[model samples]
Target: MHTSDEIYHRVLWDPRFDPERFVMGIAERGAPPKRVALEDFVPGGEIPWHRVVFFEADGHVVWDRASGVDRVGEVVDGLVGPEPGDVLAVPAGHRTAVAWLPPDPLWAPIQHIRRAHDRQIRRWPPHVNVLFGFVPEGEFPRALPLVSAALAETPPFTARLAGVHWFAHREGTTVWLDPAAAGLEPWARLRESLELRFPLCGGRSHGFTPHLSLGRSPDPHPLVREAEALLAPMTARVTELVLLARRGDEPMRVRHRVHLGTGDVHHAAEPPPPGNPGPPPAV
Candidate 1:
């Protein structure tokens, strides 16, 4: 499946398909498409984990599930999906998409528990973004203004969120369904038009993996595993976007929120530091 033009994705199910087989061209300014073929030192069981880590590819439209992933827990936490992934190809685009507010039943507990697990979770930040494309570096500071204009000019789009599932990744890195797959398309189309002008301007490139993120590795596995049944399906019209600022492993600081259809920017009462402090060291 192609998430965007020039970007391709394939789910590698065959155990024997070594990553070293194909040559790919990556995205680089004025650089010729490098004839790069890679090798894999992975076994099938670890592919789920490996797929989210050990790869550092970008600028190429080839969405190799077997391509560029880095092994750091924080990087992998953001890169991997909520579900255990057999998927490859980190998405290349902007994360400036719409937002979904899950029902209280699902949202409340996840936030509480994930907060307690804050010191341990690598990338479950309780937030999601509909990335459009990677933007040129110099143009990023205008993110808020651009989003504001689009929201005011564009009408609110429809989207649905209706599933709850538990997926385990790596050493107990578990996540629940924010199910961006269920709701992002309509918003994705909307974000696409503006994205042509702006790519990953809002945040890091997380590929196509989209989920609300319940918690992470050091969380209680059996508890999270069983609580899967407690979740109920939810669908709501996404009407806004929450701009976030984080400080390592402390907590997510809400910077601003932009209402859809109005493009109104709701700045935080106390804004966070200018930028994120990034992921903390693994405990």
Candidate 2:
């Protein structure tokens, strides 16, 4: 049996298949009849045209102009109940078409966050970006304090936002840190230590493993190398990730940290009751 998700996709692909109205089409930069494949039938006498298909769903065109060449224009128009400028291509079976639009802008907020951080860095003192290790489920409460204390004592710079993160140990790799169980914190000590010992160790947070970072510095290779050497001998359990944020914007600083604690415990502004609420009063 088709799962609901699969059925939804099918509907999105061809809503008309189920007699339910949907839209699909290809959007192009320039005018319609966007040239696609070319064929020479009689020494280029009006050149044979290739078929195109346009897919439409939810009243919007999702395919690009190149994709429109697949569906015979007439079929797409008919599927959408006809409209002007709906040119049809020969050999309808040869082409497929779909509605196309610009990519979604859901990531706008992230862009804003980046901009805000960039602006703040200009006024703040020097700092370094460091990736802390992950805290397994049910370990955040115990770990967060250790991380917090480290930052508090960390000389020169202070720890800022500690939030969950997703990162890869190597460059060009991607991983996700469960937001429900991740946290970030900014540490000043780490930053100053690196600067004093290895000035060149700045701005090299590109491909650090275990995938959590504090902030960017100039070149971090030497500092990271030294820190690893030192940490190897001791028990280095990362309880938090940190960054430097504006003092007035402390909440924003905390917003980015990943809480690796269990059951969304990191989100609670206040402590919960001794026991769970069994049920609601009768309505």
Candidate 3:
């Protein structure tokens, strides 16, 4: 059964978002719709989560757990009455990511390669993606403590760019620099811990391979050699894990920084509103 947090997550990031024209409510068939405190709403305690939960947009029920069986605009009737509390506040229209951001001079050389072939140079910094397509941006606040707890035991370390490599995609070839095994071991362990709380944030089809992407290239062999010469000798002091986000097609910006060893999280003093362009990374 879906919890109110899950429903709120859908409302914020799902394609059907329409705060101006949408309403969240509960009702039994033939009963009038009513607003209830989401925090106190217990599924299976009073009203079953799936049977009575519903969302309305533009005057019609767009989603109702009791879909085919219930009437067009109402949920299947539930047994108990509603409770109290404010609607959970959530930001909208952004996707989140977790990464290890290499600082300063490291960014310069990476960008040099990126400037020539990487289309995403401006979209993201020189980063080793630990988790991409992470929890929705609106949920970062809720996810922070869990992320901190998962990473508490993983101490910071120097990460070396051991070599350059390439991956062949259907469209083209992409070049990236590999992190040394010492770095990979800790990163892998941290990823394993995070997976317990966020199973969906794991790497793509082939599983995780820690690398800092140089960019996409039509002929990656020449770029790989050049990147190897320029970047393979570099080492980064990885003391913190950064959480970043972006709206559609916009450049990503840092939302928070989770320090390693101590597991302390640094929150943004004033976060940009959903859909607005955010400040550039301070790295």
Candidate 4:
């Protein structure tokens, strides 16, 4: 966890709970604890949760462990969720986005570089963002049908991650990998459609660059060169667009998956594990 100025900075881990499972960012000194959903922190895996052993010193082991839950639910029930009538601060990560999450093998190399250079490494997994901060989570129910209609005629296509590039900003230089711009016309058309539906969320901060972000640094040329050697051209089949949401600065988690062509919506009960590495393996 990043350093906090707050008086109480806590992380929770449990050796007995999924062995590799832990949860953090759940508590702050003065605020109501955020809702703790098993699907948010853990990735989907084979292990069943037998019990929860909570430790105070620290803190992802599965997504959708909901069905296999036993004593674990009992522990989470007491620890999770906001207290009644408590006011909570709106998190910067509150906004939502639509993106393509490439398979782990494809993005793992870029992620390896990001682990050292990217501050958002823990906040989000690797993805090629389509539309970001487009609407609020509450607006998704409405947004879903709009997205479905916009993409109804569009079919899934394959995207290639081909090269390294950068976006200059006053804060730093953001290095990214190109998702082959020539093939992104369909993505552009979909954006135009959604913009018609949600005008306020239409402006592109980086102006329509279809690249998967690596990370940012004040002087990034050296790291950019390093990434160039480690990175290889990769292709990912784009079958679905993932709708991601977060609660009050918590890490973003999958909310829904909108399939291409058919526009069939799937409520994500257990999102697949993120490409980002989790806790160190048990010794």
Q: What do the candidate models score in CA lDDT, each in turn? A: 0.43, 0.27, 0.64, 0.58
Taking all chains together, each candidate's TM-score versus the true structure is: 0.46, 0.20, 0.63, 0.62
Q: Pick the candidate with the highest lDDT.
A: 3
In model 3, the runs with Cα more than 4 Å from the true position are 1-94, 181-183, 203-205, 269-283
Q: List the residue pairs that clash in candidate 4.
A: 11-58, 12-58, 13-58, 42-62, 43-62, 43-63, 44-62, 44-63
Which candidate should be chosen as best, given TM-score against the real structure? 3
Per-residue lDDT tens digits for candidate 4, residues 172-267, read 899998876448687776665554444345354456767788888888898789888998777777788888886676666789888888889887
- 81, model 2: CA deviation in Å? 24
| TM-score for candidate 4, residues paired by index | 0.62
Candidate 1 Cα misplacement greater than 4 A, ranges: 1-106, 112-125, 131-141, 152-154, 157-159, 165-172, 180-183, 190-194, 200-206, 217-225, 247-250, 268-283
**Superposed Cα deviation of residue 73, candidate 3 (Å):** 38
Full candidate order by lDDT, most accurate first: 3, 4, 1, 2
Per-residue CA lDDT of model 1 for 59-92, tens digit only, reads 3233434344322112231233112122223333
- TM-score order of candidates, best first? 3, 4, 1, 2
| Every model: Cα RMSD to truth | 14.4, 22.0, 12.1, 18.3
Candidate 3 lDDT over residue span 90-109, tens digit each: 22322677878777656667
